[model samples]
Target: MSFHTPSDMKLICGNRNYSSWSLRAWLTLRKAGIDPELIVLPMDTPEFEERIAGYSPTRRVPVLWMGEEYVWDSLAIAETVSERYADSRLWPADSRLRALGRAMAAEMHSGFAALREELPMNCRARQRRLTCSDNAQSDVQRVSELWQTARQQSGSSTWLLGDFSIADAMFAPVAVRFNAYALDLPVPAQAYVAHWLADADLQEWMSLANKEAWIIEHEEVGE
Candidate 1:
């Protein structure tokens, strides 16, 4: 239950209003009780281009700095945090459940291209309307099915699993997308999205997102 907080920990991220990957990593660290120094670089700007190279080899956001070592990619950061803070229980103890969680997280990470393109994670935007393509609709349906299966297996009505794990962190941005676009979903998935929107940490993130002035014009979809 106790772990040493790293003094040299820092998390380099992008504008919270539009960076779903950043949200994932930030939520994971916050859930693990680690508040790293957050460095927000506005995306699609000369500043980001110049500064990102110093922080991430991938030239991406949500890179975690543990002393001189840096971990890029949100999933990698989640895995590292889960391993380093085993006592935090970032993943379920049961092997089967853990496997299922990993699969779900991986699917979210690799798939859902249509959903990501059509329904970008705009935390500050809400009650917006968008006519999703067939592929995007299929993606939403797939996400609903995944959530239903995970909750049914774990008997958890709140989180995807019985507890808040890396799986939840991975899908947290999807929840924001669903809410922001007012995407029509099944009752259970709707409830899940509501739960995520109600999370205090996520609310704090959204609060900061709303205060951000820089907006990615391309990501400003859904009228």
Candidate 2:
């Protein structure tokens, strides 16, 4: 009956293979060093819809169940935890950096529709030259600009805003899209994607995804 944990937290997520939203929330939690009870639900599993009812009224994955409050949606959960744990550096420390970070993250949450539709996340798929449509290409260009500007503005830190903040979590799906579709990137975007691809959490997530037996036919790319 309770997804909330004793003190840390509990995060209910969807299958690693297709749940981009879940990845966003999970990355934020992992970055914050809050070990939540991770419960993975298969996207197409009839049980998934029924099971998620425990997390929130929305019956969606990436729901964070805290002590007394429940947060639905990936971005909302990220903000909630950030408010609770500032030491986690969920948002950029500086006001300007935070503003820019929110702008970029908002783009990630709301934009890139074409790219997302074209290149759904498939961790096991080895797509060396998957071609995206023109709309998807435009999305890629915009994403590349975002990466370059954020990386340039961040002073000494290695992440988007000098530290691995919510900005990085926001663009996590874009990184997957580029890798999934094998989209060619400019120098700066390519470098940023490279580091993101090599991330341990991403690697582990992909590895686990590859082993999953479940698959939603709609999300599967045409071979």
Candidate 3:
């Protein structure tokens, strides 16, 4: 399938209040300045399958429907947008930086299972003093170290791997989760989280997320 008008491109997403993956894809599109039509649907509902079957084989949120072709998976969606809009600087400009950023994003896309399980992405909820499992703490430690390391490597840029790229989009949800759960981070990671929270784009998304009334039961943490 081929894309025609910008209006023809659609982003099929799920509940903004709970879907981390959706947020990743949506942020990537936004970073690329591609504002496609957003198609949101209720998740964990009986009609969810019927609603999303046409958009994704996996029946997942964040299916980028580019007229004739649809891309599922947040990482894949980010890659597609980067390739389609090379001028957008979705990835870093330097080849080595770009490669490293991709590695970080890829690791984020595939790892951090413990963190995800213990602290699901709850944008509107803040839970302080929740006990973390050893595994979860380990995951958090790794994340903090990675953030500090990336910042050091970035050399004066506020964003990871220097400049706002797909890697930042990938880690955006983690920043949200850290803030929501009151997870402790080292000075560097804490600063990185602050940067993400201070972003205008993230603030906009948070505003929309705050307006969402749908609450997924399992996603609510420390309640």
The pairs that clash in candidate 3 are 1-68
lDDT of 1 by residue, 107-221 (tens): 9999999999999999998879989999999999999999999999999999988989999999999999998886779999999998998999999999999999998899999
Best model number under lDDT:
1
Two-way TM-score contest, 1 vs 3, winner: 1
Off by over 4 Å in 3: 1-5
Return the lDDT, model 2, position 118: 82
lDDT of 3: 0.84
Count of clashes, each model? 0, 0, 1
For model 2, the superposed segments whose C-alpha errors exceed 4 Å read 1-8
Q: Which whole-number lDDT from 0 to 100 does residue 194 have in model 2? A: 74
User: Candidate 2, residues 1-223: lDDT per residue as tens digits?
Assistant: 1222347467888888889999999887767666688889887777887888777888788898876778899998888778775464788768998999999989888888988888887766654466678998999899898888887887632578887888898888778766766667898787777778898877878888889888788787746
Q: All candidates' lDDT scores?
A: 0.91, 0.80, 0.84
Question: After superposition, which runs of candidate 1 have C-alpha atoms over 4 Å from their true positions?
Answer: 1-5
**What is the lDDT, from 0 to 100, of the residue 198 in candidate 3?**
95
Instruction: Kindly indicate the candidate among 2 and 3 with the higher TM-score.
Output: 3
